[model samples]
Target: MPLTKGRLLLAALIACALSSCQTADKPPQPRFTSTSKDAGSATTTKVATSRYFIEFRSRYALSYGHTYVVFGKLDKNGNMISPEVAGLAPASHDPSQYVVGHFIPVPASTGWTDGDLEEQYRSASWRVLLSEAEYRDVVAFIRKQQAVSKTWEATVNNCNAWTGEIARHMGYKTPGIWLRPQQFITQLRQMNTTG
Candidate 1:
């Protein structure tokens, strides 16, 4: 039997759900590329009072969207210096990995993923300042999480859950994992910011 319009729409939705973190646009160059000037200044005296921060972020993607964390030190002038990103997604750009991820665990990547830098894709963000001690602890936790993160399953081990673990480590309350990335990030900000 020939497929109907409704069937076609349902199939499209299913495909989108399976290919969760894929983006249609070609990945853009990162905004914070190191320069020769920066490389030459590596031996400068360390600032006595630097601010560190972790920004929980959500961005648009092919599926429900993505959530991640950007963290690093900031100068007294509030300029970022060598920020790092971490998130969880299927290891391969191949759609099959995302498809299988919905059923069985698929290999996952815990470092920077697509849409981390495109400002236009950002939906929500919550940035929290950290003391040097807190920053060290959080960075260590993120690195350890990256080292151990092995697989991705849409419902069980998706991006939201990964970020939630980081937020919990920082002593912030996280919304439930089932929420869309944008909603989860927005609620996270509201829940943690209010006294």
Candidate 2:
């Protein structure tokens, strides 16, 4: 039986419409296939340690102008996990200044006119006055500073890296203050060597 032209046109249009509707109803397929083998890329990891040197002093009324220095280990999380620190005292006849309660380094030659025995006695007198109470506060503050310092370094902006740590950790959040690592190292070295 030969189909009429009108009937054939109607059948073709219905087939086309059904095919388009079926295609439209289907869900999207994923681009990649499942694989049992893992890719063999090895992960590289790095560990960090925080090292610190400390000096603390006060010249307020009724208090002697005394200074002390302590060096200790710090953990990966920037905590001072060690309870004990190596104590140090200044060289006798060395004249130096303390910046905001931290001692600054002086020239080695300035320590004494003569490496005289008497000068040694004087330097030895500048011993660390460590007590359990003061030690707790000092260590706690240092640990706080260490954690914040690393976080600030990750910022990587020249000004932010320098100033951000001090401002945030020290609670001096006013903008534009720069604190370089070298400056910190110098202060710590001075304190460690001085007292």
Candidate 3:
């Protein structure tokens, strides 16, 4: 017997349903399972990833017998920001626009002269792994520090003080006063042992 239009349409619908009529947007879900020790039962959970690591550098070397200048003896903010000496400074070098933005040419003399090392300084680096929420908190803490350090002075609020603030914000202990560069780096390493 010949089939009616309704019967033909029903047959097509059934065929499509059994074939590949499912929407592509909703593919499949991934599951992770764990078994219990006592009850012999299992549990499935969805795995997620939302953690990352950020590295902050705290570097310094022994110099002038006083404190390591975090970078080099002459790589302070004043010198780096305004390195305008003839040979020691980079003619009209703005340290922020130096070779790598952070690296300021090591001055020739202890003060400022014509022919400095023009090389980068040595430092210690610390890496911290944090969650998304933690990253935001840490960055905000750093910004606050930068704002406060805008009026930093060599005699009082020096480079060591600046790095110390950042380290302290990240849950590390810093010295109260007159912190040396190498010593501060040592403290950072000790605290970031797990990270």
Candidate 4:
């Protein structure tokens, strides 16, 4: 082979090596590769252990004493659910199917609407921090509740009841304070000393 050809090949190899080194210095982005199986495609998500908060809310000002609770993962900046939404529509605007004057345990994530929460939430928060194992345990508890029975009562068996059950299962205390959503969840928070 000619000397010039050999030199060109060596230069190309050096450039490639330097470029690869540069790329390795940057952090890799999370990638989702989808695969088609049968008639549908599925994308597997990276299941990193996440922390969740049991957001406790209070009764709305004009809601005639109503409250609720929900679970949410802490965001990248450590933000959990907030019950505050300024100037939201009234509870009577588009009454929540699961929250308004009723007592039923709905899935925390998709149970109520934003307006429903803002209209009813007075001012309180009960956040239960969860490890990965605790998160799974809490999830199973929720699933069992979902599979069983669901009944709603006017002021008796309501969303606070749902959160109370969750609090007990999560190894917290529920000292029979079932009516006031605000106070009940505050007790749960006080009991969540470990997680």
Candidate 5:
């Protein structure tokens, strides 16, 4: 059949319009589906409504027989931010031997210059040794607490009334300890620049 240019153009437009209309009127399709028979089956999954902050601890050894713990942060303020824990030990080598416990503050003037083994031992007042397994447990504890404190307000819901409570609850001591505000902020800045 012979067709005019106008007729062909009109047919094309009509077909396009009909296809778009059909698509627009169709029902919405689900993106995900469960194969399980039970609605509450173990395989069935639901998206979590809440999220948590996270901290990481890399393994490190101390001068003495103790494992050093260094704190790190993974999530904060709806962003995935990983920051190292400054001025702390990461893991101990011989935790059992260092019964005095771990924690020896190095003087800024000293500049980490404990040259001799004897000198380092003398300077290290506390004797706390941590095995690799114990150190892992501590790191896990820190991560768990970080997850719990999603918001500053929720953290303040506790008595400490501070954003660092999550870190503290995991085993933070006094000034300049793990996850202190100044130290954490410093580490965060370092991480940002390094990346």
Candidate 6:
């Protein structure tokens, strides 16, 4: 028997669920970049300092997608070292929790959920270098957020919101959280880069 429209849709959803958080496409190159400037001394000499960085990233996923942050200290050669990841998502791996989240809130898990390390799935990213003080503050704030954030809802509170909080903490303007992960990350980069 030929499959009906409803059957096809069901099959698609099931396939998406099974393949969620997995992708085959190569990771997109970093599309946005920002740097922090150090002030010169009264003697007209500039001091060198180590730079840390926070990267707001988006990746492909089952539904609209996912957004998260990767942050760490940068080496003298400007490479990330021991990057840390954080994001919010349904606590349960069961697909039902994600489905229920669309209509109501579900328990959330913050910090290093799946799809974080798979570079191929990354859709967008914004990297901002920070001062030592700023890096400490941002890391502390992320830890506090992870401790307090308890729930997830698709429309009200989700991955975008999680990253938005971090962006705001870093003094960057944020876009609407309702956008797809890729769009949200792009807008966030554009907004801060221009102003």
Kindly indicate the candidate among 1 and 2 with the higher lDDT: 1
lDDT for each residue of candidate 4 in 1-195, tens digit (9 for 90 to 100): 699998997677556433422321112112221111111221234222344644455443433333455555666555544422111112233457434334333323314534345433444554444565665676676667655534454334455665567666655567443344445544454444322
Task: Give one digit per residue, the lDDT tens place, for model 5 in 23-136.
Answer: 111121111111111212221123222122222111112421211223222232322234223222212334442222222211111001122122222211111123345445
Off by over 4 Å in 6: 1-29, 37-50
lDDT per residue (tens digit) for residues 1-195 in model 1: 356987887677667565543434333212211111122222223333448877788887777778899989887876668889999999999998887787678999998887786788887776666677878999999999999999998877899999999989877678988677877787776666531
The lDDT of model 4 is 0.44
Candidate achieving the largest lDDT: 6
Give candidate 2's whole-model lDDT.
0.27
Task: Give stretches of model 4 more than 4 Å off.
Answer: 1-50, 59-61, 80-110, 113-122, 191-195
Cα shift from native, residue 155, model 1 (Å): 0.4
Ranking by TM-score: 6, 1, 4, 3, 5, 2
**Residue 132, candidate 4: alpha-carbon lDDT:** 59
Candidate-wise lDDT, in order: 0.74, 0.27, 0.35, 0.44, 0.27, 0.77
* Total residue pair clashes for candidate 1: 0
Clashes of each: 0, 5, 6, 1, 16, 0
Quantify how close model 1 is to the true structure by its C-alpha RMSD in Å. Answer: 9.9
Cα error, residue 190 of model 4, in Å, equals 3.5
Model 4: how large is the Cα RMSD against the reference?
Answer: 25.8
Candidate 6 local lDDT, 1-195, one digit each (tens):
356987887676556444533434335645455664411111111222456878899888766678999998877766677889999999999999998887578999988877886887888887777788888999999999999999998767889988999988877789988777887887888777753
Off by over 4 Å in 5: 1-130, 153-172, 175-180, 183-195
Segments of candidate 1 deviating more than 4 angstroms: 1-50
lDDT (Cα, tens digit) per residue for candidate 3, span 1-195: 356887887676555433421222111122212111111221232112223333333322222111221121112221222222110112234443322212222221122222122323323333344456665675666545544433323334444555566556666566643444444444545544422
